[model samples]
Target: MDQETAKKLLVEGGTFVFLGVPQETQFGIDMQCWNTDEDFRGIKMIPPGLHYIHYSAVSKGTGDIAPRSGIMHYFQKKEFLVKMWDKDKDDMSREEVSEESIQRLKDNLYNLDRHLGPYPYEIWLKWKLLTSQITAELAAKLSPESGIIRASVELLSTSDKDRPRGVKSPEGSMDQESADDINTENSNEAGQSTAKRAKRATAQEREDAMLPDLKPAPGTALRFTEIPRDKYPPGSTPEEITKHYLDQSYTLELMIEQQEEPLHIIGELQFSYLCFLIGHSLDAFEHWKELVILLCSCDDAIHKYRSLFFHFIRTIEIQIEEMPEDFLADIVMNKNLVYKKLREFFRTAYMSKVDGRLLTMIERFKENLTEKLQWDFTGLDADEEDERPVVVRLDDDAE
Candidate 1:
């Protein structure tokens, strides 16, 4: 679909909820039912293309949704659903939104608190009340088995202003556990459906909170000072420069290469090193894979830094896993990237730039697998062990 269609679908099809907060922090967490292009309410279909649900909250003006509280949630279309359904073909199809099928979703959403975790009061109240009414009205618009598409409703919590407008709190007979299955036939509907917009924050507050704080963490050798690329050959693209650095056709040994400016080379090296460093801290395997791809982009084999870089990476990974919990926190918060320790080691080995030694190399990349399996097998035993002393080896207590 075109961008305009995509943007329209986002606002129309997606469910918006707000996480009420006083600050103008525009952050959201979206969850998409990727099995079907349809959403939880089966109200709209999402268009394809790297589809993702945008769960963001817009800040309230001084007196819109709340005096200073912003919108709890922002809505966006679930583009990921198209990809997910493509991958998981056996999953429910959009055509299968019969009464039987919708009942399952209803059961799931109603029991969401039980299935996942407790939801906020506003979400619990709004979804329960609105969906119940919508479900009952199904017979009027469509068959009970026929899928009824309702305009996606924004689920929200009752603000202090909304509370006094004859909104009745759920009666004492309504058990929190049983509240999920509230019968729509007996419920009252909310009136005056409207979207409330939040006010803008002052320029200073916006600048302070919106931009990423890229300061160097304490104890790290690196310092951030944004240097413009005016010094480097201005026309060279980042990708081209990186490729040139790693090109086997080029050799650092060639004396002619020494006359070239250093900024491009330094920039490429720092970029690769940053990727390698971040790979150590990333929890997801996919993220590490992406980092590996980034590292490969800096592959200038003529410089002959392979062995040192590989071993440096190995050491960082091992040391991060080996660090005590307290020390790990310090490394994470202060030393910055866990692999940054390798930078100093790299500097020390700069003279022997072609050194084949790995400073913290593991015998094999077996530690990660073994550690993962140990936790998987230990299950709840792992939680109990948090209070116990950590052993140097998994078999430390074994004969």
Candidate 2:
């Protein structure tokens, strides 16, 4: 931004007043983060729009960091949003500050200005692109009731009846072979062997103990739209149902209907991506992948929602480019879900009657991915042999 623009934002932009944050706490707004010092107060010159504020409490002694927690706030022009840290809870306070206190702070704004950090303007454009479709209403609707998104959700124990029966042991638990080996190695003499067996028995007992069922703490779960289990429409023929499963246009439609508008699907897509990318929420990442798969599986929607698809292509292109290298490697190794889905989408576009403009945009997107990421988009129109359905022919004369 130019000096004039920066000066304008400094005067007109919203202010976030975070009070009583401890030193070394990870604090961020939008895409930027910093470890705070004693002098740190909050962020200023924040561009007024939808932004995610996230933080993780750092342990004083061990330097261990807790799972990240974030909140999405849509800042109005010149807004002054205030929040305080709770020392006892080691989290942001839920209690509201009194108006008198706010006024007193405002009265001493000049002195406090030195402690505030300006929002990083360089990332504003990219951040805006990432969240362009997300509106205030959509943010409110999808955000948790407590308005906080946590990487590791707080869980509450459930009743005995509600707990699952015969819960499977967690991954990396001791197997029977390992236990047998231990038992054999310890069987030197009767008394020592008996003591070892008893110890093993106690260990087994602890392992066998049923853990209580836990659910997310109230008002802390993201309200993403549930993907429909039934992929096909009601009363469809077997062949149509099979076709619906292949294309998933009906399922995508159902998901869109759950939102206020068709474009809100794109909005939710953007919202989920940001939640995962910034908030570091695995739940949000799952939802983001689900949305991506749903969007890429549609054929009819390509024509009906050309604009949405256009933005989606642009949105995901940036997202893929921005993905962490190691994470991208993992995605590429695991059947390359995004690549396969995009191939399917491209195939559908070629086979179906989609808008020429969309086709052009899709071609460009494919080319960009190929050039930058070295992703092969060759033979997209060809169906995989494994995916093709076998057909059986019956003779009419025999019937």
Candidate 3:
């Protein structure tokens, strides 16, 4: 931003005052992080917009900390908001402070003025784009009623406890095994002592699984009640399978079949993104992962769900674009796992007989992802004619 614009934003921006947090607690808004001490009590001159505020409580003598928590809020110009941290609970208490207390705090604002710091204007635009569509109402709707997300949280599960990350309910590890380990067996010698049987879901896994995912239950997954497919008798042909697919509903059917409105879907997507990338909530991230995979795997539904896919692409595009510099660094340190999985789905649909509009949108989505992340997917798509089989002459084989 230019100096004039920066100054203007500074003059017009809002503020968030978080009080009572201890001096050494880790706290941040958007992608910025700072240790709270007596010198600073609030963020000032913040661009008036929707932002995800997250924080963690540091432990003494050890790095271990409680699960991180995040909340999305929309700030308006010149707005002032305050929260009183609960030391006992290790969070900002949800109960409202009495009006007398509010007035006392307001009166002391002048005394505390020097502790507030200006917003990092340099990152305003990036943050704006990331949260443009996330509104306070939407956040409220998707968040847990009590306004917290914890490690023990799960989504829409009937179980009594919050499921931990990476463990399926009542099952062993869901981590995928390597291809090289396909046929490997337990390393027990002939008639030698056998190793103890693999344990079932650990106590930790059991606890995590019972934690309900705080998101609105419906948005956890797409709702496609029914999709017709041909069930041919014993000896079905390729033609039969093709016909079965054709018999399914037309474009956007899967999305339209949603029990909830499209707005709910979008809100859920935004919520999941916030949880994973910002809140660092593993369960939310898992849901986000599953949703992305489910959408990408919609090769059979792509044509029948064209509009849905179109909106889905835009939803994911914005989420990717909104990723913070720090978060993106962590996400891609190994590999862009989310992007790679999405690319697989896109490539699969592209290789299939997908709707033209959906295909074009998919390409555009990939282009945006590449541009935003500086990623290279150059070799993913290939010329069909180059890879397809060609008719050969008998004489050519002789040569």
Candidate 4:
């Protein structure tokens, strides 16, 4: 898909995944890994911070990706931004990755590939890793039934060279209002030095707030309810189990039908486990591999879930609390076995789809996934919730 389309998918479709919209909800999966001293072995320790992502999928042609024209915002990184897309219908091998395509990805990403002299391919790999991680975290949060992601995405319109050297927050002059309840400003030298004291949410911070509220519980995955004998017959065959499971949701039914739409129909089911996580209170990372297995094993009509497994992994990152960066790196590297199992699940699901609702169900599944992923992380830190963004009250709305 072209970059514009990808961006749209990342935005619109991605929003659905992130926001936790109603049915037609998207589906995604995640796995979290802890980065402790043992996992790192002799390496340096990870800094304390959150690191997770969400991953969601859509048909290649179903979304838009053109560069947008508006305030371009993103988390700043020292490395060159590279935009990778499938052009000329080639695999992602270095040989097939044309210079023009690479340039395009760079240009589309940062908009100034010419200025960036030259960097090793490993940099791109890091970008991919980061992207994969981000996507996976997002997907995991989105895939669950309670995946309440509450974030927004905007396109990067301006060229890198044309962009400002260091963009400032829009309301830099604003300060915390006093008890009198009116607007106030803290002007200092040239409105620059005081910038440090200004507190506006970071993109990551905002995203953190946007995460689904699993209060009383912690993560999005639903806790498994004991399957009564009525739900699944005693000694039911694996095939029967699969079929019975598929019969539960209309989303899954559509996927099995697999109409001629470009999109694939994957099965739809709310993560019962996520509800469990929210109600029972649990960490998102601990059950990473199991979630991955479930997602990778979805029996969609087209059977192309493999292409999007990593995307699912990236989505998972958002639901969990952030981790230290170095620790995240270790988990990514050492968790090779988990991926193998995930791949196997994908194979198994493809083999299991007998009726065909899997493809259509994919859309509904995504719809659901997005709901769990896009959550409002902002909680009443000290008191009850107030509907207005500007103020808080102990009781009664502030008129």
Quantify all predictions' global Cα lDDT against the true fold.
0.30, 0.85, 0.64, 0.32
What tens-digit string does per-residue lDDT give for candidate 4 at 172-196?
4434333112312334445533233
**Which portions of model 3 miss their true places by more than 4 Å?**
1-12, 61-64, 151-264, 299-311, 314-341, 348-361, 364-399
Query: All candidates' TM-scores?
Result: 0.19, 0.85, 0.61, 0.22
Candidate with better lDDT, 1 vs 3: 3
Lowest summed lDDT over 10 consecutive residues: which window, candidate 3?
A: 221-230
Report the C-alpha displacement of residue 149, candidate 3, in angstroms. Answer: 2.7
Tell me, what's the RMSD of every candidate? 30.1, 10.5, 11.3, 24.5
Predicted structure 4: lDDT: 0.32
The CA root-mean-square deviation of candidate 1, after full C-alpha superposition on the true structure, stands at 30.1
Candidate ordering by TM-score (highest first): 2, 3, 4, 1
* Predicted candidate 3 versus true structure: per-residue lDDT over 335-374, tens digit per residue: 5556565656666666775767777887888787678777
- Residue 135's lDDT within candidate 4 is 28
How well is each residue in 247-278 modelled by candidate 2, as lDDT tens digits? Answer: 88899888888878888888998899888888
Identify the candidate with maximal lDDT. Answer: 2
Please identify model 4 stretches exceeding 4 Å from their true place.
1-73, 76-124, 133-282, 301-399
